[model samples]
Target: MPSLRHELLAYAVPRVRRSRELDDAERERGRLERWHSGLDRSLPTRLVRHLHQRYEVEVDRTGDFPTHVLTPRTHDVEATVVWMHGGGFVAPIDAFHVRYADRLAQQLRARVVLPDYPLAPEHTWADSHDALVEITARWTASGPTLLGGDSAGGGIAVAVAQSLRDRGHEQATGMLLLAPWVDLTTSTPSTAWFNARDPWLHLGKLKAYAEWWAGSPEDLARPEVSPALADLAGLPPALMFCGTRDLLLPGCRLLAGRAAEAGWPLRYVEEPGLIHVYPLLPAIPEAARAWRTTEGFLGRSFG
Candidate 1:
């Protein structure tokens, strides 16, 4: 049985069904702009701001994207963690992203870099993937590194890692994917079947958003857009989390199978009845456990 806290958190989050109107593009873009404007005032940001008072977080924007570097205040850093923020491929980073990235840096005794990647509608993968490749190439040079993200960001994290491997660059030591949207094409049956069941996602909205982000149907097959279609061999070990109720669970499961077949080291955990990206919620016990487990995994990789 899922934890009562998980159930409560799931219920507390309002459902995000697909809008029936054809003007969703304009409306979604407007909403995204609003979300970006209010992120500094969000509760998660406030709490993390309070907790991270002692840490050193340097904000850098000299590169292709805005990056936040969170350094552990206490302990010698063990590794670097580069986490991408998920906004369904079109949305910008929010308070939750800052909180999670900060927490990961503190807990893992690592330097955490949160990159604000290019979003869809305004930019395509061509614009973002190259920037990411450049950023990861520089970050991974320091030593052991972990790549991670939630939802669409998780998809980006894996794609970036694969891109590095393909280029003969040193890949990340490991990866942490939370409810990754690995397949944008809706190729997996669960993406469609679980649409009504998922509290925060719908297949109709997802497909539309993906199409907008990808810019065309053919681009969905590109490894940077959908890492599920990319070669999974010879990348670093990975830890993946998914919920049975998430519409993207089938794609995650498919990736898990591919990883196993390719002899890639992947630890995948699927929590029954939980929502997508549950680890980002922070209030639930499952979320806490997931972070702890991730820290342990990172420890093993760094050691």
Candidate 2:
């Protein structure tokens, strides 16, 4: 059963910030203007302030965009995590993303790398894919490194891992995916049913976002854009979580099914009646339990 807090968030978030408006905008001009007009790509001020007090934060400019590295001030680093922030492929990183990364660093004693990758309409997956593959390869060369993200970011993580394997580069030790939007086509038969129940995601907006990120209808099914359709063989162990209330649930299920057939080591956890990225939400019992599950997965993977 969903908690009261979860229920409240599911109700309140949609009312305050609706994506239908974005969906209804003119496809090219209006959508692009609205997306980039007042976009602030920097990390949240509150998150930066908190990181300064408790962790060592450094900015890496070696990539196409900035990647923030956070290490605990009081603990030795046990591993490294490359965490991608989720925003349906357009939104910037928010406080919740950094906060969750910080919690991972503290609890797992890991160095967390948060990449501010370029978003869509202005940039496509091609722009950032090679850079992320290089970054993951560099991290894995030193020690065990995990690739992780939620929503669109999770899809990027999977694509990066695939690229690494195909290129014969050092692969990430594991992956942690949260409600990943792996299929840009949004063609899953069950997705329409889930879309009706999802409070935050709109099917029409998701298609628009997909077209923007993919750059064309022809590229929508490309493995880099729709990783669930990619060959899952030879990838590292992965832990994935999704909720029934998310439109992305069917895509995650598709990835899991493919992983099984390809002999990929993937453990998928599906929560009934939970909202998108339920594990990342604060002040919820379900999120706490998800964190514990994450800790356990990290322990096994790092060993």
Which candidate has the highest lDDT of all?
A: 2
lDDT of 1 by residue, 75-177 (tens): 7888788988887887777778877877777666778787877667667787778788878888898878888999999999989989898898888888889
The sequence of per-residue lDDT tens digits that candidate 2 reaches over residues 94-162 is 888888877766656788888898887778888888898888888888887888999999999999999
TM-score of 1: 0.90
Q: TM-score, each model?
A: 0.90, 0.94
**Per-prediction backbone clash count:** 0, 0
- Model 1 poorest 10 in a row by lDDT: 14-23
Which RMSD values do the candidates have, in order? 2.9, 1.8
Report the Cα lDDT for residue 299, model 2.
84
Which pairs of residues clash in candidate 2, taking residues 3 or more apart in a chain or in different chains?
Answer: none
Clash count in backbone of candidate 1: 0
Give the candidate number with the greatest TM-score: 2
